[model samples]
Target: MEPVSEPSPDLAALADSVREIEHHVGEAGWDGPVRVFALVRTQEMLRTEPGLAARLDPSVLVSAREQPWHLTSVEQEELPVAPDLETLLAGLSWPSTVDGMAVSVERVVLPPAAEEAMPQDTDAALEYLLAHPERQDVRLVVGALRDGPSWCAVRSRANDTAEQVGQGPDLVPGLVAAVRSTLD
Candidate 1:
């Protein structure tokens, strides 16, 4: 098989932004899932929403007139919190040929099996966890460009790991499929 190509500069930037947001939300104690959608540009968008067309680059418009252009949207909607997140995600639908997505999920931290050794006080347990590098909460963020690159970031209760960004369908396969399902 031929080697996979790298993500375009635009997708790379979007992934970086997603990672930044993930870190910020994790620090703020957000232990819920967040989904970010990417809106693409189409000729119909130009006609139905003239203001959108006006804001777009001239070259982009010209290119879009021939084929849909992947213009990432700055606006995103946070879906309502649900009991079954996967079911909720599976129910979403999006316009045709939309491009790109970012998803961040903050898992609730569970005390290790050795909890009996730690202080019973919640505050003290938390402090102990922070003081011990081996025990820390973790948050993961995944970003994807439709039919393109995908990147991921992992953050701990104490610090963010060095980013691991790359181009591949396998980077975050399940998340990518979840996001792609919306566009379909």
Candidate 2:
């Protein structure tokens, strides 16, 4: 990695350079092992306060990140290619650092069919999904509005029976945990 020597002389040009770096990285793909590490020294030197970091949007970070193998959901959408569930999970708006790599989750919307599949009888399908953990990872957060039909949404990490929309079917959280507990 190139050491940070000094800020660039041309501010506008430097911004453009960063943009290109992001673009090229994204054009690559996420294939190899991943890791994410935050350098305290660098953060301290840059004076990135905790509040600022908290306020920063994970979507922006995820959007700019690069993986080594597959096209991100965002990229596929931009290409107008419909992406499957696996692709969407790989690109959701959660910041992850694996094997010193960092990527953010931008959007985690469930697909139309999946959302519709959310059973009218809340407990059964959700229970089934929980029963089979493998199925959980493949599903997205698509559900109907509180009073409306199914739509797409990101299920909460905290609640299961309560989806983000009104009182629609529950969206399970923490796939591994839900499976472990339910299966146990």
Candidate 3:
């Protein structure tokens, strides 16, 4: 792993930020989990420079609830006018750059149906999310499901594209939280 450049001079200040995030979750007691965000990049980038991901761990990290990184062939109609599942999967595989590095990260697709159940913006967020993928680096795409948990679907951009890998219970939440934090 490449070494981190250097710990910030005010490491204590950074610690405070973490505590603050924890406080928000604690005070509000947001029963739902938080998501971490990341840019889809090449495996080489991840392999050669582990420190990059570690440095971003705090600001972009998230904590998850009871769920797994699931990928099954969901029907097109089931998704909103949000576009085809294949299109999204293909777009994610398409190469993109991050920090001047050639990386093609997978896009996380949350259905419109899933978002409607949440206690947040319930309007047509899916159409906008699909139409403008570049406006935001990474987003927690929410979809509404008629008969699923309000927190139905969630995903994150993966560094590698070939295989569908998922984080362990704890790391997934941190990663989701990080990504969500960055998007917000």
lDDT against the true structure, each candidate: 0.59, 0.28, 0.28
Worst 10 residues of 1 by lDDT: 160-169
Which residue runs does candidate 2 get wrong by more than 4 Å?
1-111, 131-184
lDDT of candidate 2 over 1-184, digit per residue (tens): 9896642222222222223323333334322111111111213322434454455356533433321211112121231122643343344332221101111222233446666666678688666445543332211222111111221222223232222322112333342222122112
Per-residue lDDT over 1-108 for candidate 1, one digit per residue giving the tens place of the 0 to 100 score: 999887666565555556555655555674555655555545656667778877877876775665543343443576756666467667666555555656666543
Alpha-carbon runs more than 4 Å astray in model 1? 1-7, 10-13, 23-29, 39-75, 78-81, 108-136, 160-172
Best by lDDT: 1
In order, how many clashes per candidate? 0, 26, 30
Query: For candidate 1, what is the TM-score?
Result: 0.52
lDDT of 3 at 53: 52
Q: lDDT tens string, model 3, 1-184?
A: 9876743322222222233322332333222333221222223343556665565434232211111111111112222231543343333221222211011122434456644443444354556555643432222222211111111122233322212223121333433332232222
TM-score sort, best first: 1, 3, 2
lDDT, model 2 = 0.28
Error in Å for residue 64 of model 3: 32
Alpha carbon deviation, residue 106, candidate 1 (Å): 0.6
